[model samples]
Target: MTQIAEAVIDENGQIPLMEPLHVIGPHRALVTVLDEPPAGWDETLMAAEKALADDWLRPEEDEAWAHLQ
Candidate 1:
């Protein structure tokens, strides 16, 4: 079976898979590393961070977690 998995290879060459794989048996795989980020990656990432912050930095969020604190 041929399948592809996504992962991040850390500075020390440690790889962490992005998601769970449901394969039953062990399979050998190859990893490819990119030396640079894709075009407009910074803009895309900033937009995503803003979108998350809009949802995360709300007054209701504080009320929701008031009990925990």
Candidate 2:
């Protein structure tokens, strides 16, 4: 199955929606849509690098991140 991320709103709060993927054949797969257009390649890469540098690397945070992975 293919997973698509989306934003959804309800009583509790906004939630992310995922679109299901269909398998057409043994070696083929298809997804209907994208949430948004892709961001600038260079800008996106720079932003990611900046974010990584800004966030302090602590032991507890590292452990939590590992759990997510």
- The 10 consecutive residues of candidate 2 with the worst lDDT sum are 29-38
lDDT of 2 by residue, 1-69 (tens): 554444434358544344644557665433344455444646878879867866747676788789678
Clashing pairs in 1: none
Tens digits of per-residue lDDT for model 1, 32-53: 8878764576899998998899
**How much is 5 displaced in model 2, in angstroms?**
25
Separate clash counts for every candidate: 0, 0
Model 1 worst lDDT window (10 residues):
32-41
lDDT of 2 at 62: 82
lDDT of 2: 0.57
TM-score of each: 0.45, 0.26
All-Cα superposition RMSD per candidate: 8.3, 12.4
Give the poorly placed runs of model 1, Cα more than 4 Å off: 38-69
- The lDDT of model 1 is 0.82
